[model samples]
Target chain A: MFKTTIFTLAIMAPLVSACGASYAPPTQRLADAQSAERSAAELGANSVPNAQLSMKLAQEQIAQAQKAMKDGDNLRADSLLIRAKADAELAIAQAREKGAKIEGEKAVDDSAAQKATNVGQGATK
Target chain B: MNTLRNLGLLCAFTTAAGLVGCAANIPPQDLVTARSNYERASKGPAQELDPADVHAAREQLDVAEAAFAKDGDTQATRDQAYVAARKAEFAEVRARTLQANQTKDRVVAGMHADERKAVALTSAELAQTKGQLATQGVVLQAQAATLATEKQRREEAEKRAAQAAADLAKFATVKQETRGMVITLSGSVLFASAKWDLLPAAQMKLNEVAAALTKEDPTSKMVVEGHTDSQGAASYNQDLSQHRAQVVRDYLVTRGIASDRITAQGFGPTRSIADNASPEGRANNRRVEIVVTPAATP
Candidate 1:
């Protein structure tokens, strides 16, 4: 039995190392990805149509990462968390872009309205 | 037997590792996308507006490329490439957001400047209008003052004319005629028969008339006329009347009436007012008449 165990380890070592899989838990990676997802949500990522796809993708990735963790595939879970983090960050960027675009448009309208109001007052006066 | 089995298992695992290597000959779609995303991001405003983010994206793409070179089509390689692509997209999005923010800032700044300019122009206009109003107010005040002075002067002139008329009526036979106010003095009282000199009693009455005439408006004009009855020769009577009119005019001038405004005229029996057959009528016909033309009313 000891010889069988030694043989199995010898065969698995190269494959495991080639795939860069690890036995250590990906708890920190999971926390990082969850934090990013929360930040994206706080920025109203889901409300922005341009950011919704990214938000959905991030959620899916995070769920898959959790499943990988439950199945004892910690290295795979870490990899999935990395993808989730990227998606969540992309969502945040898209949401910010939308917000900034709206702000820019509003500034233009507000400037025109102010000009119009000033002209009206001048004419009446 | 165990050593031989271990050797066989090691050879099998080595062959599987080789097969995995052979399968990774072509790059995965994820790596291809990551490379394109990085290239596009570098060429876009992301490089200039967000250099650090672009640099991070570039670094992530490099890592993905390295993984692809080491293990093509491997899950690790694909995952890294996917993350790199997302990083590049993040850089692009962040740059866009920055651009939008800058546009808003520029517009808002311009708006404020326009508002300030409008306020300045309006203030200048208000100041100019106020200055014009001030000047107009001064002109209106001056006009009103001139009008008031003119009204007071007219009122005083009217009062003076009325007082002069009242004084003349007290001592003389004052009458309104078409020409003007006439004050008639009997020739018998003013001069002796055929004499041109004024009698002493006539001088006193003439003094009172002179005082009233002097009180009249300075612009008024006066004429003194002498008349006679038909008893004397026509030429002699005309000469006597002429002398009598001149004497009365000179006397009035010496009593303070303006000489330039008073003139003397003479008329013999040709212009008598009554019949020569009656003594009282002839008496009335022989008279000295003073006519005063008042100043024109305002």
Candidate 2:
């Protein structure tokens, strides 16, 4: 009875974990209407998105894969492991980009008025 | 068939011999108690099962009891009953634990679903607030732009007023005072000696200057500064200078400029632009200087 049940369960489990994974670097860009409204108040759009949520999602997927293995679903577990690792790497890339965006925005906000004044005065020329 | 019969005969003879020998540790008289006290070593500390776990748990106890009293060797049968008892105990506990874990897992899963729902609702509300903020941001940006433009217009008007002043003067005398702007007018024209009263002609000229200031910016934020020559004691001159500047400001207020925007200050010979040694330079220093300060662009 144990052998029969184990074999049948293994066969059934393959269908659950068998997946066609698609990859996309998800980005949230503000629409023109939203940007216009934001510009009225902050004089700028929300340039930084929540990158940590993505990292957490990737980490969660990795945990789910580990759980599948412990639940005696190795074939499904193996497939999830690959996708989870890829997502984690994607999250790292997003983190780097987010940091760069923050630095870039600070640079823009700091020098905006001074640069505008200097250009008007013809000091550089 | 003959070999089977001989083997069976050997087993019977052995049992009969064992019945004649030692039989000390048979289970107690209570059938229900014996079953209830079955060894539960295999399942460890997990909960024991309900009566529903096995269909024949009680029936098996009765069967073992009957065998202990009739035909079978008491000691051998008792050992067999105890082994079965341990297995029943383990299975009962194991079944109960499995059922409890399933129930707990279901409750946890339900809570997770509820949390997910709450998160989705919060996300939608956040998106809406962000949208409103974005709209408000656009309006603020436009208002700020209008303010910037107004500041630029006022600055241009000031430049034009300065050019007009230069045009009005047949000989434009532009002197950079060390302290600030100091315009010199004769004492006879401004006030009578030993008296604080301003002359009618001098009041008219000062009004014209104030009108010119109004032309520079309708919002004429200015300071009326008065100075005195070192002809008297420090305290007297300070008081006299302050009185004169206040007089000038009051006259300007009557002319049209708002009182809130203008400030009257008196520097009584403390700050001298030219040497007090010469009469002409002292006269220049003694003059009432209207210092025009620029407002913030914001």
Superposed Cα RMSD, model 2:
28.1
Per-residue lDDT tens digits of candidate 2, residues A1-125? 99999999899777665532322211111122223222322412123243344345445655665576567555445544443443343344344444444554554444555445544643322
Docking class of 1: medium
Residue by residue across B1-298, what tens digits does model 1's lDDT show?
9999999999999999898777777788888899899999999999999999999988998888888787667899999999999999999999999999999999999988887888888889999999999999999999999999999998987787677667656656888899998898889888888788889988988987887888777899999998889997998888888889999999999999989999999887788789999999899889989999986687
True contacts kept of each: 0.87, 0.00
Cα lDDT tens digits, model 2, B183-227, are 444555687664567988777677666666667554536777778
Return model 1's CA RMSD, one decimal. Answer: 7.8
lDDT of each: 0.89, 0.57
Interface RMSD of each: 2.1, 24.1
lDDT, residue B238, model 1: 86
Q: Pick the candidate with the highest lDDT.
A: 1
In model 2, pairs of residues that clash are A37-B134, A37-B135, A38-B134, A39-B137, A39-B138, A40-B137, A40-B138, A40-B139, A41-B137, A41-B138
TM-scores of the models, in the given order?
0.68, 0.32
